[model samples]
Target: SRAEQSRAEQSRAEQSRAEQSRAEQSRAEQSRAEQYLSKTNAQCLKGIFAIAVLCHHMYQYSGLFRGKFGIILQALGYLSVGIFFFFTGYGLIVSYQEKKEFYIKNFLRKRVLPFYLFYLFLTAIYALWRIVLNIEYTRRQLIQSIIFKDALAANSWYLQVIIVFYIFFWITAKVVKDTKKLVRMIIICSMLYCVGCFMLDVTSTRYESFLCIALGTMWAVNKKRVDKLLDIKGLQLFLLSIILFGVFCSTYIIVDNLAIQIFSKMASALAFSSMAIIFVFKLSGRAEVLINNPVTQWLGKYSLEIYVIQGIFLLLRKGTKLYIQNPYVFIVVCVIGTLLLAIVIKSVYDWIVRKCRPQVVNM
Candidate 1:
């Protein structure tokens, strides 16, 4: 009897060891899976960022189509902002995931400085245009416009919001390492937005919608929930397309009546952005074949510069009315002209960067 009891105890011990080994192996596999997902997440989002912005630009400037297509384009424009925010959050958090020690100078020099330089350059261009057109300009207005204060009035406030959000995100992310705290920060910003609405005396503009997006991005990145969405298939995409079209049509129908209402842009922005996130998840990996093409990827690299210059091109066209006989034709010419100019400028910029790199290394 004693021998039998000892044998049974030994059998139980062997079973326990096998279970432990299996559990460890499972954990190892999960870790590898998470690492792979993280990599794919970043790559997938980069293309989405490019496409979403492109969609928005097309809707805004290309009046080639009207009615349902127009509404769809406009909705896409809304979704583009959300896609950008998601990428921004995912990218920034992932970058800092390994290292928490913040370098203010490096961040400013690399990330923020280029934007300031571009802002100044663009502001100067606009100032020259205003002078040529003999449009009355106040010094204060010029300063505000350059710094993004007058963005609400300018109709191109996204740039201003981007600058502020980048800085805000960098600072908050650097200071608050805890994921839970980061989420709280987002909630706080959102609450402040609500309070600002109730007070009505608050000076912040609607362009500050970046706050919600920043929070959303931060939350999503830390949660590592991208895999939850990996199984989104074609049927899901088709359904999403239907829902997006439905909201877009309904919104358009009401837009004329709501022209004067404050929430028009905000509501549209929210609805479209939601649809965009869903659509982006469906479309992310599929674009790799196209975006991976050398020329396309090169264009994608310089796309942001193209985005900044597009408004200027439009302003020039509007002022000249050079192609106004047919708005559709004019839109086509404007797009082609912008792309050509963007390529030329990017080429020159790349050349300069390449030349300077060798000299800087020697120094």
Candidate 2:
């Protein structure tokens, strides 16, 4: 009887402790969801990936990487872009869902205008450089470059592609009253484009990139369900495999003979980006120190400026041979030079944002 009573007490105590632990875990999960819903870790992730892209560009010209190292660098650059494209879609919808009022004009004024201003600023800087050096760029050419957005930047199509996605998102969000349907529409559209790519010889990176974005938005839009799904051990492993497969797909050249060629399977890119976002969402708390470090925080804070500024400098590197010959020297010069310019550009951007629309600075 004494032994039985002791075991009974032990069971009750264990059950009570388990319940409390479950409650604490639930609270922690909710807190984490809120953080992922916000832009802090988003910025940190952006900063980290943008730096990867920056190095990819620098190495492209530096004669630094050869063989598999080169492939890895290329994959880093491309996959980083894939991650970015997904977040752009995910973040947009996440913000939109949080809003009481979805004002297109206000969104454009706040988000699109700042980007356009930065692009113009970059164009103006390039134009001034050409004029000062008497390198002979036509005004028409400059205007076209600014309008078309591929004249000088290392990865020129990114902004243009994203803007199109933004516009399409707004239009579709208006039509689809339900978030689920909106996500479905995007998936259908992506599938159609992929079909064209494989069957019609129409390979448009924009469509595929939009697919990645769509998947991201889908993840965010279906946050509650997906979060629960992510808790499943089997599902997590499956998603992880999908991500790896996607990375493998993104690495191979699609056009080569003996290549799998189904566009190196953009599906891989889509899966990898989607899983990566979920992974980051899950790990945001653990990486907070690196995420919130002063330099990294600054980098994360001003990632867009860094992205745009580095592209401009890399373009100059190509034209002016501003790059150093020695690998170490080149890396130091590029990394420091890019960061410094990015910092300066960010300050200028802040000033402009304050002067033009002080209200939007925080928004």
Candidate 3:
């Protein structure tokens, strides 16, 4: 009996040591994520994707992508949003690093509050414009337009999906401490997205954006290994190959099956977005000036407002008689004008918030 008790104690001691080792490794990984993606890095990512999605939307409205070469251009919006989700996942880890427990109220308070304020302001304008134009509407539709993302537009569905993901990630982070299981969770979510596409005959970002966000979380969890991989010999060639491969795969759009099409689009988006973000990360210190330009800094700071403000500008363009036929000229002007107007809106919004709710605004 004494010998058996001694053996059991030895096994328990070994197990405890193993668990301690795992906890240490996790702490190191968390530290690495903070190092790899600082607040500044997050801002750079937002600025890049914001301008890109803005351009993609411009092309969509301008009817610029209408032929053999247009599919690649058409595919960029998906890629851009995928990258945006990547940062969103990383951002959650950084922003909530100090929290001892997952708090849904805190997430809603901090994550959704500012955006919801802006959303209420902008979408009300959209609704009123609809009302003035005598567009057929109902009380139900008005309520839906205010609350449901699908009621707003395809692009605007991002807000709904991202908010859902904020909650999802909070739950996941609280429950699953290991990175391996997190990867599996994302893959499962992707499979569910595919099933939803099959059943619904719809393939919106609503179904697919979670995959990218999961990829982002995986990256944050394994940033130490990722940095090491970047330093491997012949990485430049590897980078080039992935970029070309990603672009080539993105152009495959000749399918009748919606499920297959959605699958392909997800693959294409992941390939292209992963390549671009990894490449930018590879640049490290060299791209600082480009990323930190005064204009870029401003764009990053108010990127969300820029996104919301574009709709207002689009409405203004629709109402006015300024006809710019050339897509490039129109996009250039739209970008410049939107940036200027968004800056003004942000300034005024900040001033008002500081006067009334300083803690909420600056928080």
Candidate 4:
């Protein structure tokens, strides 16, 4: 009888263990689902920002579209950077919400590595092609691009800016634990930073303000809010806001005095911020369908790859003089070509990473 009782007790213990394991598995699955959702939004926002930059560039190099339209498009160009910084801040802060210590390393490991690798690969390809074409090339230019310095004035000034913001944000999020205080400091400093940039006509300093504003805004928004922003049924509000912002900026840009330049610039920046707010709100809300949509979402995922590889298209244009006269055609070709290359390169990179992932995991 005692022996029978022991067997029954052992069976019950095993059943309890199985039940606990199932519960834990369920919780983990839920956690993964949430993370996938978060990453989808981040990718969506980044993809849009990348495309915006591309569009702004198209408008820019197309000499046919000049004057007021030109100025508005040019202003819109910088907003891409603004959107990028905001997403970075939001993504990094939210990522570190649970455990902040590993944020910097993880940022470098996942985001920076892919970027640098792709940059180096494409840069080398461009340099070789340029050499074959007998174009003037320098080791200094290569080094400058690698270090994210102001050496060549390549179209990738934004990449350097991204690296800067990543470091700045990582350090700040690490040191300043108080959320409210950090937000206040970021805002105050961003304003002062903008003032200094405007006074000096310092483009880099202006970019720094974008970083602070983005991170500050991200720190302000939460997960529940993010979901609502992603729901795309409310997209009209976002589109309308963007249009109004554009109009306001165009008006400001046409007024050509020094004081007005400063004010207009400020107005333009504010418009960008306003647009960003609406974008994030809608992105995090019901309008997320646009972002969560399969094609846009996939493009969003690999947008960084597109950013890095797009330079190859620029190099091709410079080398072949293709679509040089027709600005719109040039941009269209460049965009299409860059996207194709990005896909190819990203596929190879992902395969290699997956193959070597065990080593990475061990490390």
Candidate 5:
């Protein structure tokens, strides 16, 4: 009787252990699924960061929100741009992978042409604004603005950078057949671009986050390995990202040499983007609801428009009656006004495209 009781106890212990193991396995599977950055998730993040970029410009140009908070927000602006670059690189690779030959053939028409047209439209608007304001300029200056050699609006540098990168991406795709070699070439090109910017004495903002584009390409090309690293429990991954971000920030602060400092800043931006994505992935319950909602998705849809148009308001608010004295009211008006204008501009751009080239509508 004693031996039978002991055997029964042993069997119960083994059953409990097996149940625990199964539960752990299930949790791991769930975590793996949650860790994925879906298209919607990426768009949501772009939406959030787009707003951050707006606030960054608001604080920088308007001189609102002074002190530590202002400093933090200004710093976030570059990080926001870096995230955008990351998405650009990631999205290009993903699309190319999916439609290899088709994407390669139509890269310029599908990608570069639309952006260039929209940019030209925006530029014309800016030029009109100058005429209305009686800000005199020569014919040569006007020609330069139209040709993208100069800009009529603030924060127009980004448009040029995006156009160049698109061309670079298309060329690289054409020349490089191997995926690993393609990614390597992209990284090298990005590094050279940064160095050129530095040598030319371009503002740090123009080049600091360029590397993140390459980082995105690397992530997509080696997604299997990257996902393996990301396969830990959600909480663990979140904490690890936090630690890495901290290290990156510290590295930035401690570095004094100019070249090293520039590289460190780039590294910091990459870490910042990584941390943001990880935080979104690990978020649960109510917090998750806030991000994954329609409002953010809509913002993401018009993110580029919002980004390009906000500078107009920024310029308007300075030395004009349109300016709001109170920071709170100004922010609200800018956000609402910018969103309305962005929607209208995008709709008009879409209509023009449909009217001009009905056949390319699906593209």
Candidate 6:
């Protein structure tokens, strides 16, 4: 009887261990599944999109890669920006969710001030460059450039949009206590902003990607529910997202009215962003090796610097001997030059931060 009881106890122990092992394995799988848009992955995506933006600007400046290639690059440029906005919205929402008080307390200093300072610095540099080059501009034009009414730098509209979004986010966070209400307000305000931009007859560039930000916010807010609803196999989910993306893109192409096309473009951007997230999540291992490699991570770390500095080069190279005649050569030079300039800017920025830290602490 004693031997039989001991054997039964051992069987129970083995069963318990098996169940624990299965539970742990399930948790590991869940964790991997949720790693779709981790911060690192997001940064890698930013790095990739940053280069896409660069290529788009290059094509705009040089008119290289004619026909379909050029068109595709141009399209990617717009989509790249939508991805950035999506990340911004998602990041802000997740940050607020994780540490409400901390995020709110340092919202301006941590979130807004750096953007303002960098933008101000870039604007000043643009102004100085124009003055040094003796570029003709009326006082009104100069003022407008400074205020972001006109582009002083290549693709400066993005800075204006992001700054506005940051301010809007800060204000909305302060005013709305309920998360659901807050998300609704954000979406409504984003749409209204788009409408205002359209009414002002601003370049389509200014408003087209804005809805992606609201979409990002919505995804972040309802991620759990959405994830649950779409909890099919990874391949199936990926295919579904691709189908959605294709549908939206087709709608964008087929739409007759410019207004409808704009809306469709925004929808397509949202679909693309979703597809990208799914792709990365499903293929995270491969993505880590290929997309999220050291080079991309480094690029992502200095993406903002690269973005701001490349515009200066664009200005400098235009109508000057500095401009490379060969498109291929120009791209090589531009990429290398932008990376070098970005590095220098980052070094200087870091040095300034290091110099200021002690004083800040003392104060």
Candidate 5 lDDT by residue in tens digits, 50-152: 8999989778766677997876887888889999999888888888888887888877876787777877888878777766655656778767866777777
Model 3 Cα lDDT, one tens digit per residue, 1-363: 999999999999999999999999867654543343567766766787788778767766777768865665666677777878778776665444445354433555556655555555555666776555444457776678567624552245677667666666657756765556755675577567657756886646565444677667677666667767765632674577486645546444556665566666666666666676666555555555565567666678877667666764454335434456666777777788878877877875565444443254464
lDDT of each: 0.55, 0.68, 0.64, 0.61, 0.78, 0.78
User: Of the candidates shown, which would achieve the greatest lDDT relative to the real structure?
Assistant: 5
| Model 6: how far residue 176 lies from native, Å | 0.7
Best by TM-score: 6
Model 4: CA > 4 A from native: 1-37, 67-72, 104-118, 132-134, 151-153, 188-201, 204-251, 258-263, 276-288, 320-329, 348-363
Model 2: per-residue lDDT, tens digit, 1-363? 999999999999999999999999888876875576457667777888889889888778777788878977865666677778778878877777777255543666566666666667777786665554445667677767787634544354677666656666677777776767877887787677557655665444444445677777787888778766655553565577576765657555544642254445455666667666666656655665655567666778877777777755554444443434466776777778788888888888886666555263464
Model 5 poorest 10 in a row by lDDT = 354-363
lDDT of 6 by residue, 1-363 (tens): 999999999999999999999999878767766776788878888988888888888888776788978778888877888888899888888888888766877777666666666676677777777666666567786678667777676566788788878888888889897777888999999999888878888778888888889888888899887666555665787787788778877887777888878877777787778777767766654445676788889888887777778876665456443445777777777888899888888876565444433234454
- In model 4, the Cα lDDT at residue 161 comes to 60
The reply for model 3, stretches above 4 Å from the true place, is: 1-36, 65-69, 102-105, 131-137, 173-187, 233-251, 254-256, 316-333, 344-363
Report the lDDT tens digits of candidate 4 across residue range 1-363: 999999999999999999999999867654543444366766776787777766666665555568867765776656666666666666655666655566554655566665556556656776776665455767887887678754243355666666565566556666787655556556666666666766777664345336435443544455555444544343665676677667756666576676565555555555565456556554443355766688778788778777656665555446543325566667878788878877897887786455433244454
Ten contiguous residues with the weakest lDDT in model 2: 315-324
Of the pair 1 and 2, which is ahead by lDDT? 2
**After best superposition, candidate 5 residue 175: deviation in angstroms?**
1.2
lDDT of 5 at 122: 84
TM-scores, each model vs. reference: 0.65, 0.80, 0.74, 0.68, 0.84, 0.86
Question: Over 4 Å off in model 6, which ranges?
Answer: 1-23, 131-135, 285-287, 348-363
At residue 348, give the lDDT of candidate 3.
Answer: 58
